[model samples]
Target: MQAKAFDTHLFKRILKYTKPYKKRYYGVVMFAILLSVFAALRPYLLKQTVDDYIAPKDEHGLLLYISMMGIVLLLETLSQFYFVYWANWLGQDIIKDIRTKLFQHILSFRMKYFDHAPVGQLVTRSVSDIEQIARIFSQGLFMIISDILKMLVVLIFMFYMNWRLTWIVILAMPVLVYITRIFQRKMQVAFEEVRNQVANMNTFVQERVTGMKIVQLFNREAIEYEKFKDINQKHNKAWIKTILYNSIFFPIADIISSLTLGAVILYGGFHILDGDKFTTFGDLFSYTMFIGMLFNPLRQIADKFNEMQMGMIAANRVFDILDSDKDVQKDGTVIASHLKGNIRFENVVFSYNDKENVLKGINLKVNEGETIAIVGATGAGKSTIINLLNRFYEINSGAIYIDEQNINEFQMESLRQQIAIVLQDVFLFADTIHNNITLNNPNISREAVIEAAKKIGVHKFIKTLPGGYDYDVKERGVMLSSGQRQLIAFLRAYVNNPSILILDEATSSIDSYSEELIQKATEKITKNRTSIIIAHRLATIVNANKIIVMDKGQIVEEGTHQELLKREQGYYKNLYDSQFALES
Candidate 1:
């Protein structure tokens, strides 16, 4: 999001999250190893059954050999089951832990991060990206280990049975390895391209759907379709390349194995005719089975290797978020219960990046129960002040104090709990109206919710709905008007009954009628609270105890509304005059 150069060290960072479940993870790996060992044993026993039990037809030998084979099969099945279950459980557990940590890390990032980053990308990283990495743990890594172990066991047994014959099979392995390596590299690049293209398609779909209304209004549906089609074609091409390489890879591996198997039968058949006891009829059958066995695992291992490489690319992205620097973190200490709601900013100089400061050296103080209104143009750092006050972003150079204590010294959660902000853009969850208002805060009683709604004049409107407070606010509150959503937001902020209240363009979206009611509600809510309001309309803050007009992050004017109107110069006068012109 910050366009921070891609750091390939993310995979190492991800391994740290597996620390908590290392014991279970190791148990799963051990299980998989045992499963592989047992899997190889079954084939070896087939050879033994043919040579010793079936051919000889000795009664005691037959019974004992059948029992041993049955036992081997039983153990293999049980071990395979546990291996799969444990590996899957370990993968799921690790992913849960990773997601929790990633969620917290994302929340702790500065708002500026969200400004530059797409919501769709973050969603993909949190959900799909982690899933891909988890697949690497459960299926990709597990298959890889099992395949290699099976190949090794088969080779070891084959050589012990007949070294000269084994050499032919072993010789083909190097060539097989070389071909597989080349195929894996090609597949990895192709799949990585496919994955990237899919992500682009995801972003496109998300943006287009969210902006569907705008697209239709401008008659750009055809254009959007074309854009999506182009991205889809790119994705299809990438997938085609991946499929083509993968299709060739397995067959090539099979052919190489076939050549080796032919050599084994030819060489071993001649040796048996030459009266070599080791190269019996049963031995020839086993040798052929072993050669065939190597092909599947070898090919599977190559496929898993390619899959794991794709997952590694995703893991790199997921871990990038997990290991990102915490732009905002909680202080270990808690806020005093008797916090007096006094706030002071001393020489705050802030910048999102190093190039230019958003907020220059500035100072301000608001005593307990004082009402301060901030007025200026859109980019006057008004919202930045609120963000800093909430400890959402740290200043580059400054000290901010809350209740006579440096704000940073108090626990961030405690400090934020003391403040309530009604933002210009309100977001309501897809839940019941009551749950939305209460927001899972244990302290927020049902009575408080009703009271807040009543005070904000949302009670009457909500009651008109089918279920009143129980009515669902559907996705993004699409079921409600902008004004209704604003009222709901106001009630939510007020339900907290915080020591400090911030109305950030709080009434900017409501109509005149709703604005009047909100103004009255704000007056009652602001009483006896440390209040900061950012207003565009001059009439909204005419009665404020003090109005601080900011221009380019600096306070250019400060006084009561009457005092600013008298001055008739600077940002406040210009804003007032512009609003006056618009109204008239």
Candidate 2:
């Protein structure tokens, strides 16, 4: 659906967030009513004081009336403070809830969604776009409603005191409203472009910053900066359109307001008679004040409408993410229990996108507690096998089962809890080594982590570090060596005690010393558990119980390491020769 600046459906949806804070929301509306009442009463009170007391030169209880006006001012001031405070207070909370929901929803999305999604765009939606929505509350919706109410009350008073001047003032209003309608249409389209540009800039900046090491290493800093400059230029250009609209509209609005005030003053000056109640000097003074109240808000409507438009545009983007139910992985009713290590892929076929098949029809099986090492070249569907086993992506055609039960029959969380995957590039949070291992799971204690580390033979090495497990790894475990980080990952896997373990080229890119530690850790973790190891390096899988050789997404051969090497021209034979030949 196309986005609109003032869509009632969309506006109502945004308002529903206030349901949890209905009391505060009602408080805002009540304060708005009080402000309008206070504002309208001001001119009426002044008119009475001028006509009855000041004009007639009466001194009785003049101080009391003055004090009453002062009290009204104080009450209005107090109401104003709460109005501003609660409105902003409410906005902060709404964003907090929205940000939490957005992040949580993003977390549950399948790996396929992340494969095509830009991290920066998601960040912008959660951060920048949501920030704009807050203005819808703090500066746009309630404030606009308050202004409209004040204008309505002022108009009622204007017609009551003098209908002639009231009629004259409203004559110019239709033109103002017409012009505002045009501005709204123009600004809505412009604000949408501005938001688009913002997302583009965010995506570009995020990618560049995250890959800054590559940028600097390749000496492409100047090139990247130029590209970013181009993006920023487009962003500035989009904003300039909105700025141009405001620059033209506000002045025209002001001119119309000035003309309305002028008309009221010219007519009121001619009819100011001392004794006539409607045409009295006091009535004339009240009419001028009434015009300011009425026209001032009318003047501000365009600007506030811009804020609402920006907010609605932002809401459209945010809701787009929240509404993408298609990307969320399907949930299952059954919880996995006492999972056995038996795994099978029956004629499984898969693809990231629909057109090209990444995994053609294939069948494979592994017995309970057996370790199967898959050896394949790049793009041979090595990692895809691991991904499908974990249900990261659903197979195009065929079923995967564990212990004779379909894997999809189990809840996603339950299924994953039984599996542990250690990737080639280990990712550790900017937290302590202990926190990264247990992932703050609460159930897994420090002693369990230590036991796991000791089982993996890294406990002594960890103790050598300044704070042992307490040492902050910083972002991505940059403070630790590749081998140390790998050891931490092995410790994590050991602690999980998963029914199935998959190591996807885990030691391929690491230092030899780290590779040695990982090999030892692998031996400890794989015992008495099903393990699937995907490796490019042939020497690492020589001792596997069985070996599966893949070529072009199809399994070509399956046997023990020595049996595969015995074939005259087998895919595994060639791969093993080339890999070990280089090592020799």
Candidate 3:
């Protein structure tokens, strides 16, 4: 599906979005054909007024011809308005549908996809590239079709009036067509560059903006700005290429058109002077209008072709995402209705890149309602265990089971619903605390949220904030403290009352006061609930009935705190002594 050619496959797929708006699509096509007919008829009426009505001084017939021409003009004007309106209307609606589906598709992708795909690039495809796709309908495809239809109608009239003059115009068309084909290929390539640069620029800006605090902390503003300028320059260069092609092609087209029209006029005059009876004043006048109609559309076709080319390029990028096979596999049919919290991983081997295993071959188990703590160095695969249990990323080998039922057999949604996690870096939407807590789930009422908040002792902390439950967290909860964000995340998890709870370094990076609040919240949530705590802070997980120590993607030790301390040369003992020695 090279954009240089017709791209029939890509074009048809793009138009498939209009399936729901079939009536509007038909109306636009009908209007385009009607407008073309009405357009050609105007010149014919002008020729009639001059030759039949005004020539012999018949005032009544001239007035009737004038009325008919005016009516055709009015009808053409109305049809053009509706034609443009409908096309644009269809474009906006189609893009709306595409953006929504793109978003949903993105959400359904496996966690591994996000690991490599830049947030900025995805945003560009969803927002900017999708906008360009709209131009296909609004300014590209149908507009080009209408222009082609008008040119066809004009050529028919020109030949009917005087074939000799029509031949003059047709002779110049091949050169114009040759130049147009060349221009289309150039602009298609240029616009493809433009789209790529836009995605790069978007990715840079989005990352820089999101990480502004880090940028300032690292004092890299000047470096980042220089990098942006480089990307921006490339974006500007791409647009200039398209502009250069347009500037060269259009005027050449115009000159060719003018010369052809001039040839028609000269030929018509010479014939009249030589007393050719067929070349009448009416024929000359009608031919002049016909040439205008013909050449003008030819010029617009080149302009509209660029728009369509850019649209095709954009549509190609969007379809890449829509057609992706990277989505999470959801083939299971079993509904995981209240899980009993039993979890086991047997000979599980997993890797994000498949080049190096993040979790090596291992076997582990936790009985229903048991509490276990996993302590490991950074990159020791502590978080990988929780991720596998949640099915955020499917394991590469062996299998995981919940209550002895293979996790793969359980429907993804229902299985996930039974698990709740509070991450170290909690992400809160720029919305009210209440909405963030319940995640706007209609089934979870504000009353239930407040009750859950009360149960976890976070109720008073939230009420202390201005507007309390209605307080806006702002993007990623920037308006709230790190502790406050974690507290909200806790409420979010507790409101769902998930059967399995995992706390992934939830207490490491917060103030002592917030840690106390979180500790209390954790105790309430984990009471008789299956809990797995992954933490670097040995103090936080010492009370667990069992503690597993990991080293280089494998579990090296397993025991309670007292039992682990008894091992003088164990991995857990060394890690614990080193961690607490620094604190002391």
Provide the RMSD of all predictions against the true structure, rounded to 1 decimal: 3.1, 1.7, 1.5
Worst 10 residues of 1 by lDDT: 1-10
Sort the predicted structures by TM-score, highest score first: 3, 2, 1
Q: What tens-digit string does per-residue lDDT give for candidate 2 at 321-377?
A: 999898888878888866788999999999899788988988999999899999888
Q: Which candidate is the best by lDDT?
A: 3
lDDT (10s digit) by residue, model 1, range 1-584: 21112224554555666788888778877877777777767667777777887788767877786788789889978888887887778778878888888898898887767867787788888888888878777777777887788788787887777788778887888898899888877877787787688678778888888788899999999999998889999999999998898788878888888888888889888988898887777777777778777777877777887667766777777766666676446564866555678989899999877898889987988889989999888888999999998877778898988877888888777778789899998888999888878787888888878877787677888899889999998988888888888888888888888899999998887898779778888989999888999988778888888999898999888898889888846667888988999999
Question: lDDT of each model, Cα atoms only?
Answer: 0.81, 0.87, 0.90
TM-score per candidate: 0.92, 0.96, 0.97
**Best candidate, TM-score-wise?**
3
Candidates 2 and 3, the one with greater TM-score: 3
